[model samples]
Target: MMWPLSICVLSFTFLMILALSLVSMGFYFVMNDLVYFIEWEVLSLNSGNIVMTFLFDWMSLIFMGFVLFISSLVIFYSDEYMAGDLNINRFIILVLMFVLSMMFLIISPNLISILLGWDGLGLVSYLLVIYYQNVKSFNAGMLTALSNRIGDVALLMAIAWMLNFGSWNYIFYLDCASHSFEMTMIGALVVLAAMTKSAQIPFSSWLPAAMAAPTPVSALVHSSTLVTAGVYLLIRFNALLVGSYHGSILLLFAGLTMFMAGLGANFEFDLKKIIALSTLSQLGLMMSILAMGFPKLAFFHLLTHALFKALLFMCAGAIIHNMKDSQDIRFMGGLVKHMPLTSLCFNLSNLALCGAPFLAGFYSKDLILEIVSLSYMNYFSFMLYFVSTGLTVCYSLRLVYYAMSGEFNTFSLHPLNDEGWIMLRGMLPLAFMAVMGGCMLSWVLFPTPDMICLPLYLKTLALSVSILGGWLGYELSQGRLSFNLWVLRNQFLTSFFGSMWFLPFLSTYGVSFGPLNLGGSVMKSFDHGWSELVGAQGLYNFFMLNSKITQSWQNSELKTYLISFILWIIIIMCLVVF
Candidate 1:
């Protein structure tokens, strides 16, 4: 008992201390414009050198600080969230391993080292997702793991491609990579890897499926760690990736991802899945902005989004915890009257997600929108951006309406109140950061503010759309929309939007259906059919028949010897007479 309690406390304390130290170091590195690299040579090939390298710079340190900070709070929160589980120790240890993997990924600029952390993340996350030991959890884990394996394979291909550059250390090659087609190919592979990791476009299904994991894992994985790894990777590779045709390709896919997720979240009813879809939406935002050649802005939003999304998940976890593990929003209402603190935190994070003024999301998300408007882009990309932005607000407010407001729809005997001090403690810091993190990050990340010279209508477009989105969300949630008739009449349309345009089906059944059938056919035709007949079974029968004939000959050997002796005597006598 004591050991379990101490593990949580010790991890929280150590991570908090490390977080503070890393943040301070990050600031110092930024002020001095310093970057330090430490390398240890492992192997030397004819063309490529395998080495482990650690990079320390402002970006890496700051990102590490945030990851550790969020992880500490989550571990602290999990103490209460997972209190009754038999394998609490295993869960905590897995979370720690997860953080360690992210840290390894954050500081390593080399492809080989990146792959080390990348694979570690995939393996650990699959374990964590399947932590519940249910069939649904198993399926979700398989989807998540298999989806990430695509990225892992891409990264491995990138490593192989990097061999041509004589070293897997890619930091030294960024400047010259733009001039070479081969390096461009490497960049394309890296982007493909990023797309899978970030859950962009066709790879989007797993993020929502991964909600089968525990809430604490969802908060941690969805916020600062697993999903953001790809965004961070792209941020590091921005120089090599931006301005190329690959950037345009990334922009297209990312735009579709944002639009898709935002729309899906609106139709989603499951509480965690809605939030999961929101995470997917934000990931799309980060990726699209990164694809648009604004890595810093993307990084900025990534950090702020992490703070608020973590808070949101924590609050959701608290609600679900008290509701006796009920996660359907329709069963939840008047939570604000019951769990005031949790409701406040949840609403605050929701507002921040909508990019409300002065909130953490406002600083980065608004800036990204403004930058998007100012930049030259095709109409399709432009429409996807703003429509997606509105949809973000729409689902956020809709979620709030369903889960927070209206009548108390839960069981009359429920004990739903914000009495968990440890859970609240975990949420409070994130809530504060969710309110102020953007402004603070903006100041640190940008010494001089970005200058925007858009027209008044364009400048206010984001806020305008936000307000419009909020209204539509409220009305739609209330089932007061004339659009409801259309939705009701066209169940197919609703299903299409609700099912993420059937992407989950496509990613799972659609992808596996052919291969599974092919495997069955191959098994029947080869293993059970021709291969069995012509190989082992045929050989066994042939040997058995031959052995039977040999045994018969052996049994007749005495009689056969008598007959042969008589014949030989007759033949010898006849030859002598002749």
Candidate 2:
């Protein structure tokens, strides 16, 4: 078990050893978006040149660093979370492969090579999601794989479309693509691809369902690597998308995703699902901010959010692991008495998630709100940001109350003690990062983004939402009153939230049910019926009858043979005389 963890440890060690060198390159490259294309061309195309290209800058370095850091933590955590499992080595391998794909994605400037990373993420994620060998895991894997397939197809389409530019490298054409319709198609396709990957609105069902995977994977995929890939892709291509219809569309869907997930989390009871929905909401926030023409700010939020969210999941994983694999917060209570350190990590991460002042999330979360505040946007968009921000606090506080503050609900005390020590060990690094990551990275990224002044009330809207959400969450969690609008009591609202506003239903069955049934009909009416009637069976019947007639034509009697021979001789003599 320790040996398995060593792989990630070594990778983390090696990267940290090189972090200073990369940091220097990033600083130099900050003044320059560095593009290094190797001469290794995978395919020769007349329209698009497919070559291996790498882009290194502050964004790539910081993002890659954060990705690797989170992955290391996750792999380390999995050693404990997945202990006693027979296939622990296989799990570690898949996790490493996932990291490799993410790095490939991070470094590639070429769409063709990026597909290598993109498809790999989808395939490996499917395998990981189904790692438990259960029906639920299998279904979840299908949803995850098929949903991601949309993005994969979109990337392939974009790669084909890039042939129009005569280069598979999209970095060179970001500005040129802004005004051109042909290039705008690429922008539109790329946005679609991003939406599927980021789990925005219609494509969002898969994110929560993907919790069927092991907890470490949930931390990695939902928090940093898989879901953020879309945001990262859009950030890379933001220049081409901004000030265009595609950008507006992204803003619209992103706002919906943020608002929907926030509302959904407030109603969700399953501990892991709540965090998963929170991830979706945060993704929506990042995308919406990016749509507001602040890619750097969005990137900033993304990095900071990754720091806390991974820790948050790690804490959630520990609790679940300790509580005999139960994930329902309703059944959980006063875990602090049993696991004080775990509780501290959980509470602190939740606080950071709520953008509590001076916490890691505070730095980027506040910046995002303020930036959105000053932007000249419609009232709906503005409300979406503030409201979603509030809902985040609502759920975080609710989680703290139900899962951390109540009386212990277990039938038997299982100690649940220092066995979690290993899990806590994995969380320590991220815990520190989640506390100070925002402040640390903010200085590196930028001091502040320039924005216009606003009325005092407008400026404090986010704070107001946070306080209100906290108050409501306390009441609901304490059972003093029912926040019947969304959580626990209302049939309609809970149904809506439970079903994720029916988008999951629509995206899953709505997309596949029709095609699948139609295929089934074809199998019944055509493949098994019509094709059998006119093709295989009909041809066989025709050939069988012809063979039967030839057999009947054969006469074995001597008289018949003699008559046939005399008739043949007479016919030959008649022909010769003629």
Candidate 3:
């Protein structure tokens, strides 16, 4: 049985690889015949000159590899994890569509192609999120769809602006900075769209809501695919990001998001929600790095985050599976004795997330911090980085302490043991990658002076801070520390910290003063003005009331025949006159 399934999966993988190879070959051929290709085109008056032809560039190739590799892992994991489920076939179909859409998105040559792929990916995600067909799953799917749609609209607007300004080509748009207003507005919209999709800052509520999906879906979307779409968009538009004030805004929003999500993660009790918040923080860090003009650092962090975060989420899924759908960390403790291998993998991934030295996350995250420190010494960015890092350590250790180190409060109702061999096989490779991926630093893109050199003092200081954060988190989790000196631990502060959805509302409405009053002054004003035109019940009601009198005067059948005779006479009269 397993053999047939394996063969089918492998065959599909092979075809995808072949298709990608053919696309690459086409790109090369087109590049070699660039002069002929340009000469053989119909020039449109509304279209800008194609400055740079599309091809499979170094950056796109790297991301494509990441997408394919992680997607394959996800499929492999799902084969074992989702076995025996009735909807497995549907799952496989959606998975294939998901991969295909991402491929299209990556290889898209123009704005039109990208938009097509973007909508396809969005549709696929909506389907996957609602796969379970339960109320929570439906709600999650709706939220994801709404948020992605908002971003899609912004992207469409940006494209429209480019086309209107005769900068529709990717390369032409890159050179559009001279039109500052158009560029700035489009950039702002792009950032907003990216934030909503990436689950950054105030747009982050939907991601945690998305935990209603299956664990594998959560792992795939949050760790490698949907959440990273925003980062990918930023990378594609890096040329426009250079020297733009919107870059500063990106840094600000990213920093705020990291800090706020870190704080929320500290207070979250659900295991999956904790991981979700950690993902949000990691994305914020990537956005901040991108804002500082360090796309390479952002990309590197993205890779590292994908490995460890996926490992962590999978481990969490295994634990939940063993525990029979219980996701609350408060109920889990000391399974390390029975599930040693799973515990080890989980712990290692958490350490990497905490930025432990020599781990995948340590190298990538440290580089991001180094860049922030050297390039953005302003108080806001610096404080944000510091607070966010401290809180990252807090949540990383919190996960480990809660799941692996605490006293066993609940007995093992069923034998607490590792999952099946197939599950472990899917996870072990990711764990290995988490520990060893940093060694492939040369393959990763980074700024010139290629090797980042930190002073001994700074390295020591960073290490010390991480250690302190871990200890602080452990103590706080144990309730061993006094809350007297900590202002943020107060009830009001905690409540405010938990209510981050309000930030978007505040940002959208609070600044507008009177207009922000949804049902008060604004409603009254609208009612007063509209009532004068068509009465309080509105134009529809007015028309309905008047229709009775108008209908009574008509002789139904006679009126119809009379109207038909008059129309025929008018038509014949017109024809005769002509």
Best by TM-score: 1
**lDDT of the candidates, in the order given:** 0.91, 0.84, 0.75
Model 2: worst 10 consecutive residues (lDDT sum): 480-489
RMSD of each: 4.6, 4.2, 7.1
Report the Cα lDDT for candidate 3.
0.75
**Which regions of candidate 1 deviate over 4 angstroms?**
2-5, 41-50, 481-483, 557-578
Give the number of the best model, judged by lDDT. Answer: 1
lDDT of 1 by residue, 479-510 (tens): 87587888989999899999999999999888
**Stretches of model 2 off by over 4 angstroms after superposition:** 1-12, 15-28, 31-50, 447-452, 480-490, 555-578
TM-score of each: 0.93, 0.91, 0.81
Instruction: Name the lDDT value of residue 467 in candidate 2.
Output: 99
